[model samples]
Target: MRYSRSFIHTQYEVPKEAETPSHVLLLRGSYIYPAAAGIYSLLPLGHRVAEKIKKIIREEMDGIDGLEVTMPVLNPAELWKATKRYFDIGPELFRFRDRRQREFVLAMTHEEIVTDIAKKFLRSYRDLPVMLYQIQTKVRDEARPRAGLLRVREFQMKDGYSFHPDFEDLDRYYPRIYNAYLRIFARCGLNAVPIEADTGIMGGTGSHEFMLESAHGEDQFVVCTQCDYRANTEKAVGLKPAVKDLSANPPAMASVATPGVKTIGDLMEFFQTTEDHFLKTVAYDADGRLVLAVVRGDFNISVTKLANHLKAVHVDLASEDLLERHGLFGGFLSPVGLKDKNLRVVVDTSVGHETLYIAGGNAVDVHLKNVLPGRDFPVTEQVDIAEVRSGDTCAQCASGRLDVRRGIELGHTFKLGTKYTAPDTMDVTFLGADGANHRVVMGCYGIGVERLMASAVEQWHDEAGIIWPVTIAPYQVILSTLGKSPEVDDAADALYEALRTRWEVLYDDRDESPGVKLKDADLLGIPLRVVVSQRGLKKGTFEVKVRRTGEVFFFGRDEIEAAVARIVADLSPSLDGLPLLPEMG
Candidate 1:
């Protein structure tokens, strides 16, 4: 591509609303333009990067015999209704009614639609195992979208689904896709770590997320240094400390009159005790029912875990009206002396049966002390709902302290079981060897092409600009004409022509100063840069530098082609060698 003919634009000043480095750099480099808070338009440069990532995904998907297919962006509400997602997906689903008054949805994922296809086509046992994939656009109504491509309302994704006869077959095929995901990220010039993750709205028994660690990432996850245990914070588990011995002499529970103290900090300061000594009870409205979620004051509740436990579509802190309706005070409510049978309670295991605690008095400006679980308050439905913190002991090995990092999700794979293929859902079936009907076990895999591109910049950029990985850089070589010397221009033109014949090269043929051209080259992050100047031509050499390492090399005009060949070979042998889509004959 020639620079003068391209629509590439660069900005000197960053946008005021840009928060993350990827957001600022993408805008300044003219790779993306903001359309709204959560929506963006990918410019030519951004489209090229997305295409590169898509090609890598296609290569890996095709290698695994994945049949490529395209599903509609607008899905019928009946399909989602069959899967119960039409109501369960909440406001994130883009739903509307058509002219005929039939409801429809813009799909966030295609599980129901894909399984419906399987139901219509696959009829025999021979079709028990099939993998179908598509590279298509998906839409979700993000409430608070930010971080550029990391959290967007609409974007392109490569989603794949596989069907199997039984759990054993899916178990065998799951690892194949897992390994393929690893290869895809590695070929894209990213170091993504696959960690155990909550399936969330994608209801599955198990799932894994490929995460690229970045300081500006929105998702928090934990990694074990001594072992292979890692998970998203929502699903992360840590060793439970031994319960404190409180049986020496059981103190009677007593209510104390305190004035103007509602928060845990104030209670801790008033009593001069650690946070864990107090029991924090939070009231929530889950599926229209008021429930109290109790945990240690030191830890915050994992809302995801709480919602998942209740199988609720949405959960939020109880409003003042809802709490008042249930005869519950906002900041002074505890499980003890609760007369409302409708008010349910879920306790965290961190508050054991014998552990004594300081709790709310169910009255304003009052608190109870020396209260014990199972004695003062019933211990019902205890689970692990507390957020894991840094320096906590690992749950699996119980030796290493858990280290947390922020990460962007690059890929997700789920063992969906029969969630989509159950008889009442999509109802997909196949004939067995004995001519008996059976449901298909399903698995889903997804990768956001643009998110992977953004994560690459987040992982690889330096102070100057994006340090593109050699495998997926927009162009392997950038040939620049430094000055107005006719001889230097002619030499650069010859080299550009020669290199374009065999390599993906970008020639800076615009009438710009050497400083501007070099700065733009760095911003674009081409892996290899070649400069043509009269001074270097007089020295029988042209300046060549590797963008990643900043190592400079001088090649005589006569030896220019050989030097480029050597450098390309050292960095990457051929564009063909990089993972790419199958040649369309």
Candidate 2:
């Protein structure tokens, strides 16, 4: 389709609010427009690109026999209440009231709605293994939606939820989506890494996140570029460098008086040793008053697991006032009957098994030395609070060292088991061969549509403009008609018509200079460009340019259609079945 002549001179400059590469080019190229924080109005150009990506997603999802269903965007809050997620999801959910004053929300996700539908209609084992899906808009109130379309509050998404009878069934479909995700990213011109995910807020034991590696990314990933291993550090499990029993040989923990020193740095400077040489103790408010938490000071708190230990909704460092109120020292807190309340205590997996170590006095500026763990401060239980970092041991690659990188979460899939099914959920059940009722298991897969577009630009663009993949480009070929003669326009318009039967063509039928047309073509970034100029027309030739590769070829008008058709045909066939899948058997 021909873009508005206005688009050529519209001065598609990047918006001032865009903070990331994708956000800049997307706004500059007229792909998307900001509507509100975390929300956007996808312009024609952006909408077309998003639809193409969604089509690819539909193809892959359908290929997996993913049954398509359109759930309501405004879900009743009761559905979430049934699944116990009404309050569990926290404030990200956009809750509101309808005309009748009934509570509702622009659906943050469809798990609860999908499962509720299943519970009523899906009874018996015959419906045991159903994979249902939908491509719709999910509304989430992101407190800070700064990265343009990358973190929008409301955007298109392809969310799928499946029901199964067993974990093996869930495991089998895991790779189906896994392999499909790889193809989706590859076709979108991205090298996304599949990482071990924590399944946060999603609340599942086994989960994975497809991430595009980039410094501008919001998620953290640990990758072994040497091999094929990668994971999100939030959920990454790897070998930790042994903090070798380097505890002052003879393992003697003695409090040395250096006078008025309190930090590990203070202790290190006085002892003239490295962080690796000392035992690190940190105090945290898990759920109640105060219990000392310890890690090798060198390691970080893997709060993901720590939260699970306290069985609490969330955890954070104690406030200064709370510290003083509890009679605990800020940096010197340790385990010594300071169990103020249900004072939940947690330690790193490394420190969880340590027999004895120095601790805090829980008061003024005193610290315990050579205090054995069980003998010093007794805790009700233990947990892993340290996050694994780079240069640490890699659990998967064994001998290989570990490292980390940041990325955005594009797609996530998890095995949900009975999380959605219960005795009250009579809508979900299967029949055994003996006719007994059996509970069906469940799984889910999701991809953010707008985020995928943003991720591509984040990874593919250069300073010129967006470098869109051929499969998703708004126009597969841009026909730039240059020179003052109308003959050039007629010739290119005819060629554009011929190509339109099988491809998308952007014909620049405007009275503009060759330089202007070319610059605009670069800015629009159609995968291919053809110049119908008077100079070339006189020579019985037209200039054909590959926008991505910038290779120009002078080809005769007579053979131009065939050449362009061949290039497009070669790129069209297989790219169609990917991104989205075909119906499953």
Candidate 3:
């Protein structure tokens, strides 16, 4: 592709609307253009980078027996209705009407469509396992689209689904895809780690997300340095409490008068003790019903964990009316004297039995001191409600301190057992040796193509511009002629034409200063750059520089091609046991 005809416009200043560095540089470099608030146009340079990432994905997916296809952008509304997700996937989904006024939806995901296809084609155990994938655009009505390509309403992705005979088979295939994802990220110049993650909406038993570490990332995850235990905060495990025989040292339940005290802070100050000496109890309305939530005084509650417990789309602190209806005071709500039959009380393990603690007094501006669990108060359920902190002990190895990190999810894979292939629900089946039929287990994987690009920029940029990986730079080399002399122009033109067959060369034939041209070359982030200057002609030599390292060397005109070939050979990552950037037929 010739640079002049590529239709990608160049710019220098960052757009004021862009809030992040990746967004600013990406748009400024003409890699992408905003089509809408959350949508973008992948122009020539941007599209090539994305396509190169996609090719890496293709190679990895195919290594794991993946067969590619083009899935539909619009799926039948009935297919979703049957799966109960038509109404389940609410506002984020883009719903519309066809010409006949029948309701339809742009495909946010292809699980239902894939399941429907399998029901018709997969009949017996002989076809027990299958892997399928597609690279396509997905649309969603994002409430807020910010930070450029990192979070978009519409973008490109490679979504894959697989079917197997049993959970064991599903397990066997999960790791294969996980490793493939590692290779994909590695080839794309991303240093990522696989962290245990929530299966949300994908409806799977377990899942893992490959995360690229970035300060501008939206997801919060915890990584333990001692052991390889990493997990998204929403699904991260907590350290198990050391087994305490709370039955001994039992403290009896008794209420002490305390005025002008309601919250944990008030009680702590009134009692003249640290926060751990008290149990903080709060009430919330889960759906139409009331549930009591208790945690350690110093610990902050995790809303995600609380919502999961209630199995609710949303949960909020109980309103005064709901609390009064549940027979609790508005300002002073306690788990004691539990007379409300419909209300449920759940307490965190931190508020253990045999420990003297303080709680609400069930009356406004009052509190009860020396409250003990299983004695002064009887809780109905136990939970881990507190959020993990930076210095918290590791749950797995117990040696390293747990630390939080911000990361972008570049890839995700899951084992979905019978979630899609249940009988009459997509009804995908395979036959047994004994002539019996069974549902096929499933696995799904996803890669955020644009997110990967944004993360790459986050890691590989300098003060001037992006330092792109040679493995995936938009172009392999840039042919620049710095001076206005016709001889320099002839040398550059010759180099451009000669290098076309061997490389994707960009010729800076425009009248620009040597300094200006070099700055633009740095901004373009091409791997190898060659400048034809008048002085080089006198020495019968040309200047060659590596974009990643900014290492420059002089080479004879005839030897430049071989030097570039050697650099790409040594520096670019290997794919499929082959040299990097093997020319596509």
Candidate 4:
């Protein structure tokens, strides 16, 4: 492609609305244009990049015996209703009424619809263990979409679903998907880490999220330095260090008037004790039932873990009216006398049975000292619902400490055991060898095409512009003709014709200055750059430069292709030195 005839637009100034590095480079490079706050229109350059990503995904999925099929983005609300996601997913689902007043949805995902299709086709166990996938568009009503492609409302995704006759078959096939996910990211020139994740709203038993660590990421995960233990913070578990026994005799329980003291800092200043000695009681509305959760003063509750434990669809802080009606003070709440209201109580695993600690005295501006669980208060349930923090003991290897890092989720795979196939959800079933009907097990895998490209930009870019990986670059080589000499232009055009036979070359034949052309080349992030200039022609060689390493080589006119191949190999050395998977010979 010649830049003179191409609709390529590169800007000098950064976009004011851009927040992250990928957003800045994508907008300034004219790869994408924002249609709305959370929606974008992919330009020619971005479209080409997205197609390359899709090709990689298709190859990997095909290698795993996946059959590609296109699913409709506009699905009837009845499909979601079968799985109860129509009501459970809340406002994020894009719902509307059609001309006939029938409700429909712009699918956030295709699990329910895909499962229904499987039920209609696969009747007996002979038709089991089939994988179907699609590369399609998905839309969600994001409340505060930002960070460019990282948090978009409408985007392209490659979602795949697998159906099996038994749990064992699904479990055996899961590792193949796991290894395939790693290969897919690696082929895209990304080093993504897979971590244990919570199956939220997907109704799955287990899940894993492929993450690319970045400073401008939305998800937080912990990676163990000692072992292979890694998980998203929402699902991560850590050991609670055992505390030493107190040396002094226990003090008698008494109430103290704490006026104008509401926070933990106030209590610390008033009593002059460490934070661990205070018990923090948090009140929440778990599916509209009031529940009191108590933990150590230094720990914060993990709401994800709490919601999973309660098995509730929604959990939020208790409203003021709900608290007042339950005879619970705003700041002073305890389990001393609320046992009559059937309020649920969940204690943290860190709290000991005989440990005496300070707690709320059930009255405003009041607190109790020397309160002991199982003695002064009833202990019903204890769980590991506290948030995992830095330096916490690792749950897998009790010796190693935990550390947290931010990451962008590029892909996810879930082991959905009977969740989508049960009688309650779509009622998908098949006959077994014994002639008995059973629920089909399922698995879901997904990759965000645009976000994958954006994550590459985020991790690979430098101060100048984007540093696209060769696998997903719009073009492999960009040939530039510098200076006003027609001889240089003629030499560049000939080289472009020759290289186009073996590579995707972008011939910059535009009447632009050398400075502007070079800056745009960097912003576009093509791997290899070939320059045909009068100075180089006088030197009896062409000037070649590697975009990522800035390595320059003067090549003879006949040695251009060999030099380009060598540099491409040096940049990426996998599967015959090609960026994407090598074609089967």
Candidate 5:
């Protein structure tokens, strides 16, 4: 490809909306163009990189006995309705009416469509385990699409689903996909850490996410310092240190009049005590039902954990009207007098049993002292719903402390145990060896193609521009002809022809200055740059510069191809001796 004829445009100024490094460089380098607020069009350069990523993903998926198949992006609404996801997923799922007024939905995922296929085929025990995968487009009406491809409404994804005879078989086959995911990310020049994650909307028993730690990432996770325990904040758990009782001998609950003292901070200041001596209550509207969540003052509630506990589709803060209708106060709310109320009550495990603490008095400018759980108020439900923070004790090892970090999620794997294959759902079944029909267990794995591409840029770029890895770079080598001498031009043309036949070489045959050509080469992020200049040619040699290391080597006129081959070999990511999983303590 020649720069003069190619659709390549480099910008000098960054766009105002480009916040992350990948977003800024991709736009300035002309790799992607914003089509809408959350949609983008991949230019020629970006398309080439995407193709390379797809090729790598295909190879890895095929190695695991996965059969490639293309599912339609437009799916009938009846399939989703059968699976009950049509009503469970809210505005994020794109739904519309067709010409005949029939309902349809854009494919946010293919779980329902694939299960429908499995129901039609795979009749016996012999077809117990089968894997199907596809590299296709997915659509989600994201409310806040920011940071370029990292969070987009429409993007490319490689989603795979496997059906098995039983839970035992699915559990055994899960590690193969896990190891394959590690290799795929390593080959793409990313160090993604695997962490336990919540199965949001997927409705799975367990799941894990592959993440790359970065400050620009939107997801937060915690890592143990002494053990192998790691999890996303939405599902993370920590060992809470035991707290002593506020009072040695328990006293009866008593309410005191306090003027203008409503918040926990105000109560703490008025009593001159620590926050741990108080109880905090929060009200939420979980799927139109009022839920009062109680936790210790030192801890905060995790909304994801709360929603999962109630099995609700949508959870938001409860309105004042909703709370007042149930005779609950805004600033002073408690579960003391709500034992027979129509709403649900959830108490965090952090609120110790038989321990006296301060609590809401259920009246204006009033609070209760000597409040105890199971003695003064009914303990309806007790669960772990507090947010895990940095420096907390590790739940797995108990000796290690946790470090909270932010990262970008590159891939996810889920163990779905008959969630979509049950009789009430898709009804996908297979004949077992015992002459009985049984529901097929399932597992799903997905990798965001564009998100992976953008993550590579985020992980590898420097101050100059993007530093793409050799495996996924648009072109491996860039040949620039500096100066207007006929000899230099002829030499560069011959070298370009020799290299194009064997490798992906971009020839900068445009009439541009040396400074502009070199700057553009850096911005494009080709791994190797081969220069044929008048000064170097007169000295009976040419120059080769490595993009990653910034190392320069001078070679004879006839040594361009050999030097390039050797340098590219050294710059490539090696798969030799790669571990399937990280070392555990």
Candidate 6:
């Protein structure tokens, strides 16, 4: 590719809408152009990078005996309705009516369509296990899409699904996909950690997400200091210290006057006690129903865990009107003496049975003292809903403390079991050797192609620009002619011809200054940069600079090609030493 005829456009100033490093660099480098809020168009250089990433994904997926197949971008709404996802999912799942008045949907995922295909074929246990994958586009109506390709409503993805006869077969095959995912990321020059994650809209028994730790990430996770325990905060657990009994014999519940003291800090100061001595009751509206959640005052509630526990489609803080309609006070709310039969109350396990706590007095400007769990309020259900914090003890290792961190999800694998193939769901079945039919066990894996590309930029970039790995860079070498001398131009033209045959070369033959050409080379982030100038010609040598390290080397004209070949060979990332999975407790 020659600079004079290429479609590359770079800017000196960052765009106003750019938020993260990847977003700013990508837009300034002319790699991507925003068509809408959550939509983008990949330019020439960006398309080349995306194609390289897709090639790597194909090689890895094919290595694991995966059969490639292209699914549809539009699907019949009946397929989604068969799995009950059409109604379960909200606006994110794009739905519309065709001209014939038949309902259809834009594919957010291919699980339902794949299951429908499986039920038509694979009639016997002989075809027990098979891996099918596709590199296709997916659509989701994101409410807020930002950070370039990190979070987009429309993007390319490599989604794969596997079918097995029994749980044992699925369990045996799950590790292969996990290891492949690790190799894929490592080859892309990223060190992503696999952490246990929650199965959100995709109902499954277990799931793990590959995360690359970044300060600008949207997801928060925890890692053990002494062990290999890692999990997203929404699904993480911690070991709680046992609460000591405040008194030898618990005292009876009594009312206390707390005028104008509504907040936890105020109540703690009024009673001269710690935060754990009080009960914090929060009201929520889960699927249009009122729910009361109680936890120790020192802990905050995780809305993700609360919604998952209640199996609610949506959960948010209850409004004042909703609470008042249920006869529940905002600051003085309690689970005890509730008259509404439809109200649901859930308590966190941190509220111990023996510890006496100060709870709401069910009235304004008042509180109850010496309130017990089972004695004062009924123990209908108890679970862990407290958010994990830094310095908390690890639940698995018990001896290690957790360190909270932020990361971006690069890939995710789910052990779906029969969630989509059960009789009550998609009803995908196969005949077994025992002359009976059974639901096929399954697993799904996905990697966002654009997200991976952006994450690589996020993980490996400097003030100059993105430092692309050699394997996935748009071009391996950039040849620039520094001076207007005809001698330098002749030398650079010859070098471009000689290198283009053996390597991916981008020749800068434009009528631009040396400073502008050099800065553009660095901004493009080619692995090796070759310079031909009159000064260097006088020295009987050519200049070579490594973009990643900024190290310059001078080689004789005859040895320039060999030097570039060797450097490019060394720049490719290797995955020989990576483990299949990180250590786990």
Residue pairs with backbone overlap in model 3: 124-430, 124-431, 125-430, 125-431
Cα lDDT tens digits for candidate 4, 442-538: 9999999999989999988888888888888999999998898879978888899999998899999888899989999999988888989999999
Q: Residue 448 deviation, candidate 2, in Å?
A: 0.5
Cα error of candidate 1 at position 493, Å = 0.8
- As for candidate 6, its clashing pairs are none
Error of model 6, residue 146, in angstroms: 0.9
- Runs with alpha carbons beyond 4 Å of true place in candidate 5: 576-585
Per-residue lDDT for 342-369 in model 6, tens only?
6799999888888888999878887998
- lDDT score for candidate 6 against the true structure: 0.91
lDDT of 1 by residue, 1-585 (tens): 998988899987879988888888888888899988978998988888888888889999999889999999999999999999998888899999999999999999999899889989888889878999999999999998998998999989999999999888888888788878888998888877889999998898899998888888889999998998989999998876745859788999999887987667788888888888888899988988888999987777998999989988789999999988877788898888998865789998788766778999888888999889998878868998889988889999989989999989999999999998887788888999989998889999999988988888888777778877776778888999988978988888888988889778989999999899999998888888999888888888889998888999998767877887787667752233322223221
Off by over 4 Å in 6: 581-585
What RMSD does model 6 have?
Answer: 2.0
Better of 2 and 3 by lDDT: 3
Error of 6 at 168 (Å): 0.6
Candidate 4's displacement at residue 263, Å, is: 2.2
Cα error, residue 156 of model 3, in Å, equals: 1.1
List residue ranges in candidate 4 displaced over 4 A: 246-249, 573-585
The predictions' CA RMSDs to the true structure, in order, are: 3.5, 3.4, 4.1, 2.9, 2.2, 2.0
Per-prediction TM-score: 0.96, 0.91, 0.91, 0.97, 0.97, 0.97
User: What are the Cα lDDT values of the candidates?
Assistant: 0.87, 0.74, 0.80, 0.88, 0.91, 0.91
Which lDDT tens digits does candidate 3 get at residues 406-442? 9888888888878777764566777777789877889
